[model samples]
Target: MAITIKHHIPGRVRFSLAVLKQYRDLEDWIKQSLIAIQGIKQVRVNSHAGSIAIEYDAQILTEETIKQRVAALDFEQGEAKETEHQYTRGDVAMNAIGTLAAVLLPSRWGAMTTATLIAPTLIEGVNELKDKRLSVEVLDAIAVGLSAWRGDYSTAMMTQSLISFGEYMEQRTSRNSDQLLAELMQPAETMVWKLNDNQSVQVHSSSLIEGDLIELKPGDAIPIDGTIIKGAALINQSALTGENVPVRREEDAVIYSGTSVHEGNILVRVDKVGSEATTAKIAQLIYDSLSSKSEIQQVTQDMANRRVKITLGIGAAVFALTQDVNRLASVFLVDYSCALKLSTPVTFKSIMYRAAQNGILLKGGSAIEKLGQIDTCVFDKTGTLTYGDMQVTDVVPLDGTNDARGLLAIAASVEEHSNHPLSQAIVNAAQDNQLPHIAHGEVEYIIAHGLKSTLNQHCLNMGSRHFLEEHENVDFSPFEAEIKALEQQGRHLIFIAHQKRLIGMIGLRDQLREDVVDTLSQLRASGIKQLIMISGDSQYKAQMLGDELALDKVYAQATPESKSRIIEQLKQAGHKVMFVGDGVNDAPALTQADVGIAMQNGTELARQAADVVLLKDQLYAVAEARTLANIAMKLINSNIKLTEYINSGIMLAAALGWLTPATSALLHNGTTIGILARSLAAKHAK
Candidate 1:
C-alpha cells in the first residue's frame, strides 16, 4: 500500500486516503503495528475522511521509516475494517457456514470442522490470557472446547455461533445510538441564494463563504451567522433556541445558522462560515458528550472488571471440586460479565431515544441517573416560573363612570400598534376577551411613559402613575389606598385619563406558567424537600411571588456569581441540587449545580452548559424527565439482580449434576436474552 503525505511538520505526518477497500480495518491494524515501533506518540484515524494523523518522537524514528512502515504494512486480512463495532458480513457468513457444516456432517468431521471454525476465538482468548485478563471470549472458548472434547461437536458449534451473534447484536445496538445523533444533526446539502449587485444567484451551501451577502425568503433556513442588511422577517429559531415561536427580526438584528425564516425576506451579510457557526459548535458539543463517562457508567464498568476476576476464580474452584468436565464447563459458561457490560449501555441509549421523543435532550446516561438523585431543585424566577411577559391582571375605573371594560378598550386601542411586550399583552388580552377594535385619531407614543390619542375629538392619556400624577397633574388622593394595595401585590399600573382627568388604572403583572404550581407540587411530592426561588427582581416582588407560590426559600436580587455561590452552599449542606434556568445570566449557576436543566427558550450558552434541555418548552417536562430517570435506573438494577440470581441458580444446578454442558449453555444464553429483552422493554411510567 502506498500513501500520500498530506502534510509534514516536526514529529508529525498526515496521510490522505489511507484506507483500502479489501481491508477496511486496515487503519486499526496499521495503528496497532506502528505504535509498537519505539518512538510513536499518538495515532488518530478518521475513517470518514479516510485519513490518518500520527505524532512521533523525531529523535527515535526517522520520517522515511514511518512512511515505509505504513506502505510496507503486510499481513493476512482477517476481517474488514475492524472497529469497537465491526462484526462484519464476512464474520456472519462464516458463522453460518460453520454451524451448517457441524449440524450436517458426521461426528468426527463435525468435531474437526467446529474446531477449525473457532480458531480465531481460541487465539483471541489465548492472547487475553497472556495479557493477564479474564475476558468473556476466554469463557466462551472454554465452553466450546469442553463440548468438542466430549464429541458433542454440534452443541459446541451452536454455542459459539450464538455467542458471536449475541456480540454482534450488542455492538449494533450501541452504534445505532451514535448513528441516530449523527443523522439528527447532519447538515443538509442545498442551494443558497446569494445577492450580488442586488441580483439573486443560486449556489451550493458549501460554496458560501464569509462576508457573502445572502438572500433568505420565508421557509428557507438561514445558512450563515450574520446581521440582516435589508428587509425584515420572523425567524423560527427552534433548532437553536429550542422554542417554537417565531421571533421578529428587523434590519441590523443578528440571526444564526439552523434557524429558518418564517415570513418575509432579508439580505444578510455572512459573518461566520461552515463549522465556525454556532449550530456547528453545538453539534461538536454533542459529539464530545459521547466520549465522556457518567458516574454510573464508570461505576458499572469498574464493577464488571472486578466481577471478571471473581467469576474466573470461582470457575477454577468449581472445576477443582467437581472433577467433571461438563460441570466445569457450566461454571465457566454462566457469568455476570456479559449482561453487566451490554445492558447498561443499551438501557442508557434507550432512555436517550425516549427523551428525544418527548422533546427533552439528555446528554448521556449519567445525566439521567443524576437527575434521579436530585433532592433539592432550584428555579430561576423570570422566564422560568413566570411567562417572562406582562399581562393585564386587573382594570379599575375611578372617574365616577365605574366602567372598567370601556376604559380597558380605550387603552388597548391606543397601544394596539406598539411593539412593546406590555402593549402586546394588553392587545392579546383584549383579543382573548373578544373585544371589538375601537378606532382612534393619530396616536402619539411618549418615550419612557405612555401613549396619547383622540377619540371623538377628546384627548385620551394612558401611561405610568408618575406620568399621570406629575406630568398630567391628575388628582388620585381618594384612590391612594387602592393604588397602594395593587403595588403591594407587585402590580405594574398604567393610568388612563380623559380630558386631563383620571379615568382608570390598568394593572399588569408577569403571569406565572399555567402548570408551574402543579409541577412544583409534583417535585415536592417526589422527595425534592427544598424548593427555592432565586431572582434578580426587587425584594418586595420576590417575596410576593414566593408567598404566592409557597416556596421554602427565596433569594432576591442575586447576581450570576451569587447564584453560583448559593448552589455551592446548598451542596455544602448535603443537598444534590438541580438548577432550572433559561438565560445567559443563569449559565454560571447552571454549571455550578449538580444537574443543570435549561428551558427550550433559553440562550445558547445556557443550553450548552445544561446537562438536559426541555425542548418542549414546558416546565412539567422537568418532572417527566426525573420520572423517566427513576424508571431507567430501576430497570438497570433489576437487570443486574435478575442476571446474578439466575446465573447463581444454574451454577447450583450444575454442581448437583442436574445440568449437562449443552443444557447449561442453553440456560446461560437464554438468561442473557431475557435480561436484554426486559431492559429494552423499559418505558417511562407516568
Candidate 2:
C-alpha cells in the first residue's frame, strides 16, 4: 500500500492511505498494526478521508521511520485479520435458503439438506457436551435431531431455521447495545493553542509534550495534566472534583486534564500527554468495565444450563415410558433453554440503553444490579450536594460611607481584574444590581491572598481577613463580633480595607443545589435507609448542612483516605453503601462503596472508579438511576418466571401428546421470541 505523509510534527503524523477509500474494512487492521509498534501512543483511521493519524513517542520513532513503516504494510495481510464471528447478510441468507430447500425438495433429500444446514449447531452442542456442559445449543440440536429421526424433515428444518434466526437477532441486539456504550465512552479529539516561537499556533492535543506551553480560554477543556505558568483562570474542575463551582487556578497551580476553563485565560505547561493524560486513563477504565458480568447474569446462565440437563432427562423418561419417538421429539422441542438463557441479558441491555438515553451511564449489568440493592447513600458535601459556584450572600459596609451596593461595586471593580471564583462572584453580584464599575488604580494581585488597588489616593485592599489584618496592617478589631457571626453561619468572608481601616466585608457561600432536598427525599422514598454526608468543611459547617438536609450522619473534615475508611466501616456494619462524590479526593470512597455514583461534572478518576456516572448535572439523576435499577431487576425476575412457567406448561403438554413435534417446536420458539420481545420492550418501561 502506498502511503503519503500529509502532515508531520515531532510526536504526531497524518498519512494519506488512498487504499482505505476502496477497502474500508482494513482500517481497523491498520490501526491495530500501528498500535502494536513500540512508542506508538494512539492511531486514528479516517476511511472517509483516506487518512491515518499516528501519535508516537518522538524519542523512539521519527517521522521518517513511521512513514517507512506505513509504506511497508501489506494490505493482503490486513484483510486476512478480519473477524470471522461478525454476522453478515450471507449468514441470514444461507439459513433462509436451507429452509426453502427443505420445504421444496423430496423427503429424503430435504432431510439431508436441512441436516447439512444444522451441522454447525450440532457440532457446537457436541463440543459443549465434550466439555461437560449442557447448553441451549445442545437442547436445540437434540430437538432438531429427534424430529429428523422420526422422519419429520419439515419440523426439524423449521426448528433449526427459527433457532438460527433467534441467535442472529440476539447477537445483533447485543452488538448494537455495546456499540452505543462504546460510542458514549469515546473521547472527542481536541486541538489546543501551543506557544511556539512566542506565537500561538493551533495543534492537535496528541502532538503535545512536556514543557510545551498551551493557552486556554473560557470553555476550553484542558487536554493535558500540567501547571499554569502564566495568567489566571476560573477553572471548572467539576470533571475532576465533581464540584459545581469553578476554582481559580493562578501561576504555579496544577491543572488536570478533563477540567475546563470557566472564565479568563491561562498558559499551562504540559506535563502529561497521550495515554498518560488523566482523561485517557479514565477512558481506559470505562472500556474495561464494558465486558464485566454481574452476579445476576452468572446466576441466570447457571440456571439455564441446569434446566437444559433437566429437559434432556424429561425427554429420556417420556421415551422410555411410552416407547414413542414422536412424544420424545415433542418433549425435546419444548426445552426452556432458549428463553431462559437469552432474556436476562437482553433485559439488562435494554435497560442500559434506556439509562443512557436518560443521561445515566451504567457501566455494565453489575452496576445496575448493585445500584438497585444500595440501601445506605453516602454523599460528599462540596460538589455533590452544593452548587459549584459561590453566591454573594452578605455585603456589609463598615465605614458608614458606602451602601451595600457601593461596597459591592468597589469590590467588583478590583476583583474583575482577577479570575478568582470569589472575585467573579463579587463581580457577578455587582452586574446583577447594574452597578457601575468604580474607577481605581492598576490592580495588583497578591497570589493566595487578595487584590490591591488605589481608590481616591488611599490604598484599597480586598481579600482574606488574614491578608488584610496580618499582611496589610488593616485593623479588623471593630468588626470582630460581626465576622464571628458570619463565620458561625458558614459564610466565607472577604474583607475590604481603605487607608488601613476596615471598610466592608463581603460574605460568599456555596449554594445548596435546589434539587438536593427533593433528590434526598426521593432517595429515602426509594428505600435508601441511611443518608450520610462527608465533607472537608469544619465540623460546624458540615453539621449545619447535614441538619438542613436531614442527613442521618455527617463526617466532617474528611480526607480522601478517611472517606474510604468511612465507606469500609459502613459496609462492615452491614450496609450496602452507594457513595456519591465528584472530586479526585472522592476516588477512594467511590471505589470502596458497594455502588459508586459519580456526578456528571465529577473528576475523571472519580468517574472511572464509579459504577454509575450521571451524564446530566443533576442531583436527582442519582434517584432516577436507583429507580431504573429497581425497575430493571424487577423486569428481569418477571421475565425469568414467565420463561419458566410458560416453558413448563409447554413441556407437560408435549409429554402428554397434546402437541405434535411441529406444534411443540412452534409454541416453544414462539414463547422464547415473546419473552425476548418483552425484555427488549423494557427500554420503554417506567
Candidate 3:
C-alpha cells in the first residue's frame, strides 16, 4: 500500500494562524472570509512569510485556479492563543473584531494543505508556549467553539489540526536541522548505485548531515543506516556483522544501511555520515568478531503461530476504526503511545542515569529490565566464582627432607618469570611472609606445563610428571607412589626434581570467591532457584566447588560455545537464565542469556559482552538492580492503568454528550494535564 506524504506546510498559513490564534477578536474576520469561499478545506492567512499552498480536490478544483483565487483574496493575521490586541489604532479590540468580522463573509469550500515552517521565525512572535499539557486545553476550547455552533466539530477540528500539526512538525524539523548543522555538515553526495537488473538508484539531495532522516520500507536497505525514527522494522544487520537476532528498528533503536528491513517499514535517521557509514567498515567489525550464537540461550522460534493471531486482530481493529478519518486522526493525539513512547523511554533514560551515577553503566534500559527477570544464574568457574589464582593447598615432601616453604621458594624462584596464575600465587605467598626469595639463575617455561631452570647448579625442574621425568639423570622412583596418589586425589601437582632426583611437590588449586557461599544462598532465596556452575577446570574440581556452594548443577571442561548451549537448553525448558563471566571466551554465553552480568573487574572484551556490569564488586548490586527494575516496571504499569481509567471516563462522558464540548474539553484536557503532572512525579517517586 502506498502512503500519502505531504511535503511541507505553507509559510503564510503558519504566520496567519499564529496571529489569529493570539488575537481572539480576529476570529470573526477569518470566519467571514473563509465561509463564502466554497470548496476550500483550509483558510490560512500567514502573517510572517505571507505564502500559502491551497489544497483542493482535483475532481472539483485545479491547482492553478485555486492559486489565482488565493492570490486575489485578502486576509489579516492576528494572535488568538493569548495576549489582547493592544496597538490597533486606540481601538485594538475593535480592530480585532473588525478583522474577524470579515471572516464571517460567505465562502466556498477549498482544501488547503499547510506549508513547512521555520521554527525560529514562527516562535519569534508566539505569545504563549503550549506543550502537551496546554495543547489539550487549546484543542478543547476549539472543539467547544465548533460544537456550540451546532457544527461537525470533528471534521472541522481535524482539518485545522492536520494543518496546524503539520506546521508544528515543520518547526520541529527545522530546529532539528539547525541543531544538526551546528554540530557537523556533510554535503550530500549524489551516488547512483547499480542494481542487479541494470537499474540504478540515485541518491540525490542537499546536506547529508548526521541525524538526517532516511526512509526505508520492507525489503529495503535501511537508507544510510541510522537509529530508528519510526516503525518496528526487523532488520537483518548481519551483513554488517554476526548477530543471532535481527535488530528491531523502533524508537531508541538503531539500524544501518545495506541492512534489509525484512518485514516492516522504517524511517532511519543517520547517526554517522560519509566514510564512517561505509557498509564494508560495518561488515568487517560484525564479521571479524569471533561472535557466535550462544548455544546456551534459547529461541522463541515457535511463538510465530501465537503472534499471527494477535497481529491480525490488532491490524483489523485499527482499520475498522480508521474509516472515520477524523476519529482516526484523533488517535494520533490520544495515542496509547503517550505512556509507552514518552513516559517509558524517559523513565528508562532516567534509570540509566541513576545506574551510571552509582558507578555502573548499563548499556541501555532494555538490559536492566531483562537483568531484573533473571531466574537462573550461571557463572564461569575461572575468574568469576574462582579467583583464577592457584594456591599451594598442599605440599607433600619426599623423604621428609624438602619442606613446604623451601620447596615453594625454590619452585617460585624457578617460575618467577612465568605469567601463569599459579606461578604468581606462589610468588605472592613467598612475598607475603617476607621470605628471602631469589632466582637461582635463568629459567625457561615448558609449553603446556611449568618451568625448567638451574637452581643452585643442580639443573632443577618444576612441571608435570612426564616433563620432570624427561631429565636424563633424575630418578622418579622414590616420589612415584606419592605423586601418583596426589594425582589420584584430583590435586593439581607440579613435580620438582633436581637432575632426576625427587626433591618435593607443590600442589596448587584454584580458590573460590570469598562470598560465593553467601551469594549462592542469597540467589537461591531470591527466587533464582536453579543455579549452575561452568568451568574449564576438571570435573573433580567443578564437582568439589559445586558441592561446597550447593549449586544445582555443574559442567566442567566446557568451552564458551558449550556454555552458551547449556544456557539455551535451560531456556528451551522455559527458564529465564542469566550468565556471568569475566573473560574473552565468555562473550557468546554472555550475549546468549536472557541477561548477562559483567563484573567491573572483568576484561574489556568481557565488559562489552555482558549486559549488566556489576559495580562496587558485589553480587548484591545485581539483586538491587533487579529490585529497582521491578519497582520501575510496577510504577509504569500503575501509571498506565491510572491514565486509562481517568481518560476513559472523560472521553466516555463526552461521547454520551452528558458533558458539552466546553465542559468536556475542560474535563478531558484537565485530566491530560493532571496525568502529565503525575508522569513527572515519577521522576521523584521511590
Candidate 4:
C-alpha cells in the first residue's frame, strides 16, 4: 500500500497511515525490509499513527521508487490469519471427530479417509524436501504416511490432530505477543488547540497541518513541531531530550511534539506535523534499537541451523541403513531448532518491555547482555550522582558589605547568559530572592573557569577559587577558612571579585540523589566490584563526596578528556565498565566505557552518545537495570540448556524405539512451547 508522504526533507521522508495490522511483527519486519533497500539508512514505524519515517540517500532511491516499492511490498499477516483460522475451535473439533470416526470405520475406508485428511502435511513436507530444508512438518508427514500405509489409521489421524494443535498453540502465542508490542507502540491521541487568526479550534493532533498556528496552555502537550510565535511557558521536554526538568520557553523557542507546556501560554507556528515530529523519530530510533539482534542471538541461530541440517543428515543416513521409516520420522521430529529460535527473542523482547515499563530503554539485546557483565561502574559526580539541582545555601560577603542579596544580584547578572547547571542555579536563587536584573557590560566567559564583565563601570569577575585567586590574582585569604569548611561539606563555591579584589563567595550545595547510597550498595551486592567517581570539583569537595558514598576510587579535578582516559585505563586493566553521566561534558567518557548509561535529564549529546538511558532520572535504576540484565541472561542460558536436555532425551527415546514418532513429535513440540511460555511469563523484579 502506498502511504501518503506527510513531510519530506533531503534525507528523511515521513509516510502517513503506512502501518498495517496484518503484519504481526510490523516494526521488525518493516525495519528489515526497508533497511535492506540500497540507499535507505533507517526506518521507523509509529504504530500509534500507523505511519513510518525513512531516512535514506535521495540520490540512490528516488521518492517515486520508494513509493512504488512500498506499494508492492507484501507482509504475512493475511497468511498468519489463514493459519490461525485453520487451527480454530471448529477445526480442532472436526479433527478430533475425524480421528474418532477413522478408528470406528472399516479398515480400508478408515486408512483412505485418514490419508486424505493428512494430505496438506504431506504436501508441506514434500515442499520442505524440495527446498532442501529440514522441518518438523516432514516428520509429521512421514509418521502419518507410514501409519496409513501400515493400515494403522487411528495412529495417523491422532498424530496429525495432535501436531496441528501444537502448531496452532505456538503460532497463537507468538501472534498475541506481537499484538501486545504493537499496542504499546501505538501513540495516545489528544486534542490540539489550533489558532486560525484570533479564533481557537479544538481538533485532533493528527489533523494539524503545516503553517497552522497552535496555542498551548498550562498542562497542554505540544502536539506538533513548531516555533513559538508569542507568549512563554515552562515546557517539560524530558520525553524528547531525556531532561528530567522543565525549561522556560518563550518567543522564538522551538517546541516539539510529545513535550508538554507546564505553565503560562504560548502560540506555536507549526513546522512539522504527524509522523514528521521529533517524537516520531525517537520512536523510530527506539524500534530500530530493540529489533536489532545481538551476537549471542546470531550465534544461537547459527548453532540451531547447523543442528537442524545435521539432524536431517542423520535421519536420512539411518533410514538408508535400516529402512526404518518410523525411526527416520522420530529423528526428524525431535530437532532443537524451534525451542532455540523462539525462546531467545521472546526473552530479549520481553525484558525490553519490562525495562521500558521501569523507565529504562535498552538499546538492544547486546546492551542487556553487556550490562549483565559489567564489573566496574564509573560515575560523573555533578549531575549524575547529585540531583544537579543546585541551591544557594549560604552567601558570604568578604568585604563586609553585609548585602547577600546585592552580591547574589551581581553574580546572577554575570552568570545569566551561561547554560551551565551551576550558572542556572545562581540565576534561579537570585530570582527566588526577587532580585532585579542588574545592567552589565559585555561579558567574557572563560571556559571551565569564570566570567568577567563590567558592572557599574568596574571589572567584575565571578567563578571558582582557581579562576579568582589563581587566574585573576585576586586575594581570597580573608575567606580561606570559610571556603575550607564549606568544601569539607561537599558544597560548591563560586567567588565574586570586583575591581580585581575578592568581595563575596556563593556556597551552592548540589544535594546527592535520595537513592544514591542505597543504589550503590545494591550495585556492589550485585557484582559491581569497583565504584569510581570523576568530578570537576576541587579535591576536597570530591573527596568528601567519595568518602560519603564509600566509592572504591575518586578522581577529583578531572577534565573531560581525563575522564575518558580513566575509563580507557580501567578497560585496559580488564574491567567491563559502565559509565553514567548527565552532562554534555561527560559524553566522551560515556562513549569510552563498555556501556554508557545516560540520565534522562542529561544533555542531548550525552543521551545520543550513551548506549542506555534512564528515563526516571533515578540512580536506583542502575541497580534495577543490572538486576534485570542478570535475570535476562540467566533465563536465556537456563532455557537453552533445558531445551537441549529435553530434546536430547526425546532423540534418545526415539532412537531406542521406546517412543513412537507420533509421541516424540508431541513431546518435542510441547517442550518448545513450554519454554517460550515461561520466557513470556517471567515476572520482573521491582
Best by TM-score: 4
Q: Tens-digit lDDT track for model 4 on 456-492?
A: 7989899887778778899877777988887777778
Candidate 2: tens digits of C-alpha lDDT, residues 1-686: 77789999899999998887776667556654555454666767777688988888898778887787778677775543332133445676787787788778888788778878778778877887898877887888788877777778788878887776676767666655655565555343477778999866778987888889988765466778899998988876654455656799899999887666665678899997654555433333333444467888888888988898899899999989999888899998986767777887887888888888899888888989999999999999866898655799999999899999999999998887654456778888998999997889867766546788999988999887668988999988888899889879898788899999999999989888889999999999989999999986667878888998899999986777899999999999999999999865677799789999988777554666688988898999999999889988898888889989999999999899899999999899888888888888878776
* RMSD versus native structure for model 3: 19.9
**How well is each residue in 423-522 modelled by candidate 3, as lDDT tens digits?**
7677777777666665586555553345767866767777766566664345777666776676556666777777667788877777667777777776
Weakest 10 consecutive residues of candidate 2 by summed lDDT: 79-88
Top-down TM-score ranking: 4, 2, 1, 3
Q: TM-score: which is higher, 1 or 3?
A: 1
Per-candidate clash tally: 2, 10, 68, 4
> TM-score for each prediction?
0.65, 0.69, 0.47, 0.70
For each of the candidates, the C-alpha root-mean-square deviation to the true structure, in angstroms, is 12.4, 9.1, 19.9, 9.8
C-alpha-based local distance difference test score of model 4 = 0.75
Q: Between candidates 1 and 3, which one is better according to lDDT?
A: 1
Model 1 per-residue lDDT tens digits across residues 334-360: 766777777777777778767777887
TM-score of 1: 0.65
